[model samples]
Target chain A: MTEQFVAELRRRATIYWEKHPFQQAMLAGELAPDAIRAFVSNRWYYQASLPRKDAAIIANCPVPAVRRRWLERIAYHDGAAEGEGGMADWLALCDAVGLDRADVLDPEKVLPGVRFAVDRYSAFAREASWVAGVASSLTELFAPDLMGRRIEAFRTHYPWIDPAGLAYFEKRCVQAPREAGHALEVVLEYARTAEQRAACADALTLKCEVLWAMLDALDHAYRGHR
Target chain B: MTEQFVAELRRRATIYWEKHPFQQAMLAGELAPDAIRAFVSNRWYYQASLPRKDAAIIANCPVPAVRRRWLERIAYHDGAAEGEGGMADWLALCDAVGLDRADVLDPEKVLPGVRFAVDRYSAFAREASWVAGVASSLTELFAPDLMGRRIEAFRTHYPWIDPAGLAYFEKRCVQAPREAGHALEVVLEYARTAEQRAACADALTLKCEVLWAMLDALDHAYRGHR
Candidate 1:
């Protein structure tokens, strides 16, 4: 039953943003520098919001053992110290991609549409049941493959970007599978009822919508218009 | 008993960072602009951490009614939209105090000690009981008085800064007492056992320690040393 449920969720990846036109333009290296800059500048808001979302999941979780495991995600993104972790790596990517790190950090450039989608995800994490919030993070199940493809695309098609900028993707390629596997196990264990399973699937769908909406906004802002 | 508990927590204000030498130096106008800049930069981490902390408290809270009320804190800091609210106001303060908004947002200037203290508070909110986490926010109970005094000091002593920057403090002066009152009511109503009351007091003390530690790091960094 759990395998069937997981399979059902995976099948819905048809709606994932990996297939979005903006992502396609990115992968094809057809995006202009300004387009890529907009993507990076806007996505920084989403990246920065991850730790808070994870912390919310941990807070909502009633089990101590699960909370202990979930705590690592915060450390992963935030790092034990400054100038470390995925966020710093993303900033390096921003610098390598020719967007000013300060501008990205100021987040002055993020579009309203992008901020709305990211903030909605954070609010969902805070408001949803712990199992559903964990399920929402199953978006990670799709991340490793996309990250690998992204790295290859960057190297093959967008060689202008420094190789160091790809470090965040490279790290996530290793990190995402483990995270996704753990989250799936938790979801399968807790979401036993049909209603719970449906809720989990709905949460995953909402997450995909967020990613897709972010791309839609990016596409609207940068593609053809620029 | 509740009033006595509240009094005991209030008495701990003897150790609040407002009484710290660093704060005193700022009030006296004895600190250099660089020192004030460093304080603003480091404290930005704390201001930025507020919404996440509030979200954590809301996530952990079991009652929907309380969660609904608790949700307001996030909105108060994050605002109904970007370029609004207390975080934006703090950026204005940053601008007035001579730090670049980009630098403040970049968060590159955050000291290790300050980061540790702020991160510790966030973690406490995530891991501790929801009531305790809410209790920690009782520091706001002391905020209205401190904010009023700080604003007066900034205007009278540190006249170099633009008055617009004081907007955050002025706004908080009105907001804090109401927030603090709500939180105290929740704490007093819910924390029925002696043990729960003690835990609340402990959480408040830990919060005070975090603030003091941040100031200590600021004092060591920019006060006649580096």
Candidate 2:
């Protein structure tokens, strides 16, 4: 049953990739400022909502110290001061791409699929076992490298934007690895049974699909607007 | 304004602390199996569901490579193999201290505050703006040190449990800092305005209070019995 689930999740990723417009653009070599702007504007909902999920994880921890450590993640994303951190940088990204900050934050522009995928993830956090919830975050393990590639792509391929405007991705170059390393240790140490291992795998696949699906939604909405 | 908010949050923490009975014990050196057991069992809901929250975070990222890296955190918590991350270890601690896993997962047995706190966090995640949502996760910056203190306390003050059983806190010795570091970088780099900075602070305070309140509630509910 687990194997079947894993296989299905894998299939979802493949299909998602093939049909996703953003993926198509990257492959076909035509990622314009419009696409980047659209993507950032649409993804505002995601950046806005993630920490509370991290908070749930902290709250569930039995140990104060563990909870405290997890809780720090909340602060980091929140920023120590005003107008700094990845979230702010992301907002800045939208601004750089000519998005109206107020309209973007209004969150009415987000597509249904994007909302559904994110809401499903929230439900997963609220509904799944702690390990399963944490397992879903395992995707962080792969983020640093990805963020690096993204920065490179942005710099080399998309040069219309100011260098400072790309600070959000720059932040990830340092942040993703730090976060993923800790999470990886937790998973490697906590999954104590075969069922757990399978669940962990599913959690990763689930996250992957959700991510892939978001890009799919963007691609769907973004088709030929330029 | 930021200082006022921080002060307000701290004041709330103070009030919460003054009213909390169990925290008094931990502070006054009240370490016992029953107290620990209560804490562990009640915490199951939060501990078990964290990865799902992380999944939400990853699912929401705009970039593909970013999504992939973020997914690793889910795998860590959900675990790829047996006896690995924080959740399973927490359950082990519960069993060691005399908790029934069924009862832990069973809503009927959990304290109302536990349910409320966990659910509120989910709601916050669901409702917060993208930046606000990510900002809320900043609490993890402080996790590693707390985890360190916990392991030593268990090893030094509570000798009834096996060293092997202490693996949960022990494992976090490495995990907390790594994750916290990444999250901090993201928040610091992304938060771009004073208003957003303040918002991030509030989100973190809310997250911290949620955690502290859970302990407060537990202390109030179980002090007499423990």
Candidate 3:
């Protein structure tokens, strides 16, 4: 049953945003600089919200042992110290992509659709159970593959964007599997009942929907009928 | 002892940014429209972070009764639904102040100092004891007096801004004392030891520093000499 439950989640990867039209266009180099800029600018919101989301998960988890394991996730994104971690790498990517750091930091360019989607993800983490919140983050299970492809595509196709900006993807390629493995263990351990397993699956599906919706918004704004 | 602790916090109001030179200038009509715009843009980040901060406080709190009371703070900021609450009132003020709603919502204009200060407040809430977190919020205890003075200042000195933009201040005037009252009760009840009382005092002082630093940044950027 546990194997089947995990497999059910993996099956839904068929609809992951990596296969979304917008992402395909991005990989194909059909996206304009403006489109790429829009993606970078808007995606920063998600990166910025990560520590807060992780903190929410830590707060919700009642067991000290679980929280001890979960604390590393916050340190991973926020860094153990200043000028480090995933957020710094992401901002570096923004800089490499020619985004003015101030503009990206100030985030004046975020679209309504992008903001709504990201804010919903944070709200979900805040409102849901610790297990469900961890389950939603299981989207990381699919992330390593996407990051691998993204690095290759950006290197081969988007030559104008500095390779340095792709550091976030490279880091995630190494980090995602480890994080996902931990999350999977947590889900497998806690989600013992049929109902809990189903909820976990549903949470993964909801997370995928958020990613797909983000891409949908990007496509609507930047695709230009291509 | 509790009364003495509360009085000590009130004594620190001597350093409140209301008495800061920049705020004094603002109240005196010495600031340019650009300065006021900068203040509004930067302050929006603080406003945007409030619901999330409140959520952290609620999540850290283990007691059901405290969570129930704390839940209202989130609702007050985020609204019972959409297009309501303090956030909406703030955005309306943004609009009244002639800010492009997109610019404010995109939040690209937020200053580094403002963002740092606000993020620190959120982190403090997430990491500290529930009682300490609640104590930091005691800034609201001094808020009503500021809000009352601010409404008068804006009306008398900044007539160019729409009266409607001042709604957040008006709403907060009625809201601050009540919220502060609840927070005080929590602090008095939970912060029983001398060490706990000192920690609570320290939290309020840190909060005050965040607010003061925000104004300092604003003054540095916009004061443009006497």
Error of 2 at B190 (Å): 26
User: lDDT value for candidate 1?
Assistant: 0.83
Per-prediction TM-score to the true structure, in the order listed = 0.55, 0.51, 0.55
Error of 1 at B183 (Å): 18
For every candidate, C-alpha RMSD to the true structure in Å: 19.6, 10.7, 21.5
Residue-by-residue lDDT tens digits, candidate 2, A1-226? 5445444434433433334558557434476667777777777777766665665555344433344345446556655455755677888888776788888987578887888887777667656666666777766564435566666766776677677878887877777777766765566666667788677778777877787778878888777754
Local distance difference test values of all predictions, in order: 0.83, 0.64, 0.80
Per-residue alpha-carbon lDDT of model 3 for B1-226, expressed as tens digits? 7679889877755566777888899888888888888888889888877766766876566443555566567667766555778888988988888898888877557888888898899889878888989988887787567888888989998899999889899999888899999998998988899999888888898888899999988899887943
Runs in model 2 with CA error above 4 Å?
A1-21, A24-29, B1-226
Against the true two-chain complex, what DockQ does each candidate achieve?
A: 0.06, 0.05, 0.06
DockQ result, candidate 1: 0.06
- CA lDDT of B104 in candidate 3? 88
How many Å off is the CA of A16 in candidate 3?
23
Deviation from native of the Cα of residue A144 in model 3, angstroms: 32
TM-score of the second chain for every model: 0.96, 0.83, 0.95
Model 3, TM vs. native: 0.55
Q: How displaced is residue A111 in candidate 3, in Å?
A: 48
Docking class of 3: incorrect
